[model samples]
Target: MFGELEMVKALLDERKRVVVLTGAGVSAESGVPTFRGQDGLWKSFHTQDLARPDAFESRPELVWEFYNWRRQLVAECEPNPAHHALVELERQIPNFLLITQNVDGLHAKAGSKKLMEMHGSLWQVRCTKCTHAREAREPLPDMPECPVCGHLLRPGVVWFGEPLVAGVLKVAIDQIGRSDVFISIGTSNQVQPAASFYQLAKDHGAVTVEINLEPTPNTGLMDFAVHGKAGEILPELTTGLRESLS
Candidate 1:
């Protein structure tokens, strides 16, 4: 672990282009609940059931209710040390990108300017009728309306069956291709596209690293796999990067 940490620190010290991919595990450290496993049930229905376009089309009110609950819950949680560590990394690296699958908005709250919320955000809403979307942090009505088209509004997240926003995916891939250092943090590497990002980075000759609570399927692909809590590990890494700069 010590050797891996030093290797990653050296990469950061080189000031090369870096890309960091994060998932629910990072937000989990911030007290945010993941919408998977035993904790995914919400009022007898699977959280996944409510997070689909079909469900929203059938019962917009119910979908909004679930989303409202999630928004409120996430709002109560604050960004943890891992989130702040990424912010510091961004400050030090001139070419850096953070692509996150979680929509808790903690990264933005932690002051990450070069961030791509690939799964969208809990604090955003989009029009169902027309192409209109915006960040809406305040508690929304059970069935909010599009101020532009007067149609219903839905949570701006990318549902299970939905494809990721094309533009965001393109940018993320481009960053991965150009990265000199690629780090996967707190992701299970089970989700598509994102799950394969480290491989793409490797193909581009970037050094790949993984930091998770346990081994993921992509662990073998990582040049450095450090298993632990991201909150504990990331701050130490950021401190090392800082000291290296000194």
Candidate 2:
């Protein structure tokens, strides 16, 4: 890990465009649930059963109940060291972008200005009838409604069957294509589009790195694979980059 850290730091020393893609494992360090496997079951319902548009359509109340629970749970968790390290990376890199799959809003809380929440955020709500959306951190009602319209509101996250916002996806791909260094952090590397981003970066000649608790399916593709808790690895990696830059 130390040797790989030095290599990643050397890559960053080039001062080229850097892009980072993070996932649930990053937030899990802060005690946020990944909403997968056994622990994710709520009221005997799986996350996939409730996080789809059809599920929300059939039982908006039930859906809101789930989301509200998630909101409350995520609200209690704060940004960990990994999140702060990414913020530092953003500050040090002249051309940097952080694309995150986790919607917990930890990166934003950690003061990441150059960020794209590809999966949307738990802190936002959008109108079901209109395009209006806004941040709402408060405990919403049993059924949240849009202030702009009288219709019901839904969690602003991209659901299981929903496509990512086209413009945001476009920008993320463009950044990955242009990146000199691309890092995949704490993701399972199984989710689509994002799952393939490392390949896109590599195809475009970017130095790819993976930081995860364990090797992912895409681990073999990375120029460097550093395994450990992101909260520990990221701060050390970013600190090394800072020292190398100095």
For residues 100-143, write the lDDT of model 2, one tens digit per residue. Answer: 99999999999999999999998989999999999999899999
For candidate 1, the TM-score is 0.98
Expressed as tens digits, the lDDT of each residue in 1-246 for candidate 1 is 788888889888985799999999999999998877987999999998889999999998999999999999998999999999999999999999999999999999999999999999998899988999999998888889999989999899999899988788888888899999999999999999899999999999999999999999999878999999999999999999888787
| Clashing pairs for predicted structure model 1, backbone only | none
**Which stretches in model 1 have alpha-carbon errors above 4 Å?**
none
What value of lDDT does candidate 1 attain over all alpha carbons?
Answer: 0.93
User: In model 1, how large is the Cα lDDT of residue 100?
Assistant: 96
Root-mean-square deviation (CA) per prediction: 0.9, 0.9
Q: Give the TM-score of candidate 2.
A: 0.98
Give residue 26's error in model 1 in angstroms: 0.4
Clashes found in each candidate (C-alpha, N, C closer than 3 A)? 0, 0
Model 2 pairs whose backbones collide: none
